[model samples]
Target chain A: MQEELFAPGHRGCAGCGAAIAARLILKGSGKDVIIVSPTGCLEVISSPYPESAWKVPWIHSLFENAAAVASGVEVALKSLGRKDEAKVIVIGGDGATIDIGIGALSGMLERGHDITYICYDNEAYMNTGIQRSSSTPYGASTTTSPAGKVSFGENRPKKNLPAIAAAHGIPYVATASIAYPKDVIKKVKKAISIEGPKYLQIHAPCCTGWGFDGSKTIEIGRLAVETALFPIYESTEGKVTSVKKVKRKPVEEYLKAQRRFSHLFKIEGGEEELKKIQDIADSNAKQFGLDQ
Target chain B: MEIMEGSRAVAEAVKACRPNVIAAYPITPQTHIVEEIARMVADGELASEYVRVDSEHSAMSVCVGASATGARTYTATTSQGMALMHEVLFNAAGLRLPIVMTAANRSLSAPINIWNDQQDTVSERDSGWIQLYAEDTQEASDMIIQAYKIAEDHDILLPVMVGMDGFILTHVHEPVELCPQEKVDDFLPSYDPAYYLTPKNPLSFGTIVYPSTYTEFRYMIHEAMKRAERKIIDVASDFRDKFGRHYGGLIDTYEAEDAEVLIMAMGSVIGTAKDAVDELRSDGKKVGIVKVRCYRPFPAEAISEAVKNAKAIAVLDKNISLGYEGALYTDVKSALYNENGPLALGFILGLGGRDITKNTIKSIAEKAQKAIKSGRVEKDSEFVDVGVL
Candidate 1:
């Protein structure tokens, strides 16, 4: 309807999950939105000065202040009597959302600003050449947290951002994936319609960073949700209202697909770590009631 | 003129300036300023969006957001709070958002002291902000209105930080003549930026700049700072014309003319220094004080002119550059570099809220007198050992 708010012809890698997710996010937001993006892959690949891929109004200031900037834009509009008309939206990567930008993000939510924050969580710091972020899943290999002789890659499980954001008592919080493009769009749209601070974290598989075939990005994202590695769910007013039901496949169906987790399957005694990851998935399933 | 707390005076001035948005986090000395503004907002006296952010970084970030959208935004903080705001400070300036902030100057920590010092604002000297320091409570109140005018000037759309000594200027009650809102309205018009965030006319801000273009944008900020020096002076002149009060544009002087020894300092210490200088002048020892009001632009030419004739110059600094000397002493010394000026001495005093009595300042003046007589730079960096707590 709005002639593609985020047009093609940019530096996003072919088969980029973030690129697809960003495009759909704009569609969900329609045209009446002021977007704030932090320093990340989307910021680098889309906006390069005189030439920009973003057709809508957008700003990228620092690594961790997009939420703060969006909050400012929200109030500025309120001050000018335009708050009800235009919505404030912030899009950032997991590093900007879960790591460095967490403080400002928490502030934006706790203050109950009317902003829809969408974190394109590609698991690691992909913009800076495949470094590990808190959102990186357990047993996944990243440049910073590589699978060494004694190490089985990233030692910690991915940070549960949806749960964390839900704890803020904001109106809405959801987790979606690029595999379900319509689901992603629906969740973002629902978030935008909410009255106060809302968070939507999309699981975007990084083709280049995650050592996967470029074509398998979407397929792998679907497997992540299917295997309960990234359980898709929605929460309202801090309560888990719904969760994406799955047949509950083993974690290997997800981990074996990506070379980042190959060490856990190949190395001797790696089954112990694999079992640990399975336990993590099982725990997430129990927390969000994904198995039911 | 009524006896009002310095924080209340600043709050009244901000109210008179009529900011559309005020967002800040609480910190020592600076808390009361925001508290008063909050009370005003609650009472419906100040019709503004007062956002209570979680931290100083968010406070500044919120201001940047509000300012970018063409709203008159204001915030206040001190010390570590200012340090927390250091990153967003650059974002506001780099985006060319004209937000006004009052940093009630307080010391930084390790030993965790939270009293008066210029260390916080001084550390952010290179943050691309127009840093203005105030000498007293009245100047602190008056400068906030003047800061809004200077910052929002289209030609000089840069953020301005008005710094006042922590506790000394903020907590102290002083007689202040609050500018009427009618006059303040005439002085500072509503904020209407050349560009803003609107769906109808969208423009990108804070985009990452490549090396090919980054330097030029930074060069523009530098150029804006240079323009701000003149803008600050003109706005101060305009404010003085309207209100019958004068804040010497870049740097304020107290008997610096025809003096043999000149002492340079900033913040509330200037009052004590002035008293010491007058006592020395009456006793027939030539000494005067140069109150540094605009710190960021450094007011290089103005500072050189003020201290050019003095035979001996001593700088009283509450901040140390750690192994290097006082930050202001370094700047003042650099200002006189091209003029073959007198060897200026750096005196570090009153750090972490040490009381700088008239005796301490007189002793500093006496040292300057001694430097003038001996025609030698005796102490390169003097700590002025004021016996510990």
Candidate 2:
């Protein structure tokens, strides 16, 4: 077995999907990688001074600027005449990637830097007490977008972060989930091989933030893909190259799996709200040919 | 030596420093320096990675990354661009990376004016970065070289902000001696960072520090700044041995050695103040100039030593502390806490690009004369250039 670049002892919550994705990412990256993380659950949990779960060269600065920092590391390596031997990877949560940090990410991609940018999309700012982020899917209840008497949770669709990166005409862009570890590893390896900017958005199901059974983390992630709620796909130069086909289960199956969405089942007009979620899944299936 | 724009001279000096990476984002009055650097990179005069980042925030972030990897890095921005970089500025210093920046000091907005002022860099006084102000275009060019040396000193591994007056110094053409690459090479060796981001070495940078260890890390930066006072002077002495000109150590003095009334200021206005002091001296007045070159690491001891004998000290500040007095006026007063010294008056002037004539300095000297005769001043601080209501 390959050595764990992300060591075993970490403060990550039990069955944290981000921790699993981080492990899989480190495994694919192997030893010749420098990781830059923005402020998030993974950063706080892995780094607490006296110990660090990162066995690789890693840095976590602010909530944003991971992509820009990665660009610096890449450019510095290239300048030092060692660009080929190492790879720069920026890992940040959805809030940092899709929202606050998108400008820096866009700059890095458009400048055509040779780096891999990873966004572990956990929907909300899990490290900051579950505040809603732009990546929060419509109808999901977060602390900030709590399902009060007259309100549904986040009132917007999840920001299409992968598509945003692909539109930069980068060399590679892919979406994966922790449920498919092998697939995640394969896509990451592919991204590292490419010469220019590559982006990966992983569906990281946070058990603590999403109020799910810790042991059912992988099961919840699989249901998300099966329902077409989190379509897994690869795009090259703005063109969708391939997608993981789904059997197209109702979104209710995915929603029923997490307590963050328990309100839609327990409240009045709950069925109607559940139907709206199904419409979103149906849209993703039709748009990405995920049902084919 | 050739006549060059202040920005071009700085660009040539940066090339001499041989930075491995430069992140460029244009802000007015700072655009010329970055443009020249870009041209140098394209024409093969400088072999460096010129990263064209989108905003000042990304510019600083890239520098933070490049510096962490032990690469000598450079960037230039002004006013609003500097404000955009506020968040990363702390990160850069707290990480103890020696990234050097040229902040073409310009006034901040509200009515949105783009002209020379010290307020932008002064507002970032507590960001833990060393702040240096230049008195002229030539000093602006020379200080960029000094900044890299002082910042990267292992004893003082902190980011340095080199401030030159917007349009006044940055846009003005002056004869500046562009130090040869060989001399700069001898002065600045290849940067060898004790800590860096490398896959082979495998270490973490900017990791989360609990409250238990955070204060100690911050204390390290404070200690570095305390140590920088000596390092800044040492680098200047070393720089002077190689290059024939000396841009004073910390605070540059002009005839303050034998004067009763001392006038003080930073940035290009000090150049004008010097000219005014010379004119006042010819008229049999004991007025002199104390050009503030290094603003942060506030140089309190240097200020005390320079103004000890002066009967009264007048500080012409381009930046006001709003409800309080001028920023430097406050620092100078605090430095005199345990010593008997001059009755210093703070005069706020030339804000938002209003011109600072030699006569403005004379008017300030007159104010000091009145305060010196009475051994008291009418007010703590007052504006000299804002039109009367």
Q: Largest lDDT belongs to which candidate?
A: 2
**DockQ score for candidate 1:** 0.76
| TM-scores for the candidates | 0.97, 0.99
For residues B1-389, could you state the per-residue lDDT of candidate 2 as single tens digits? 79999999999989999999999998898999999999999999999999999899999999999899889999999899999999899999999999999999999987698998888999999999999998887888888889989888888899999999999999999988888889889988888887999887999888788989988998888999999998988888988998977889999888988888998888888778878888899999999888888888989999999999999998888888888878988888899888898888988888889998999888888888898888898777888967766
Candidate 2 overall lDDT versus native: 0.90
Interface RMSD in angstroms for candidate 2: 0.8
Deviation in angstroms for B194 in model 1? 1.7
Superposed model 2: Cα runs more than 4 Å off? none
Give the per-residue lDDT of model 2 (tens digit) for A120-166. 98999999999999999989999999999998788889889898898
Residue pairs with backbone overlap in model 2: none
TM-score of model 1 relative to the true fold? 0.97
Off by over 4 Å in 1: A283-292, B386-389
Chain A fold similarity by TM-score, each prediction:
0.97, 0.98
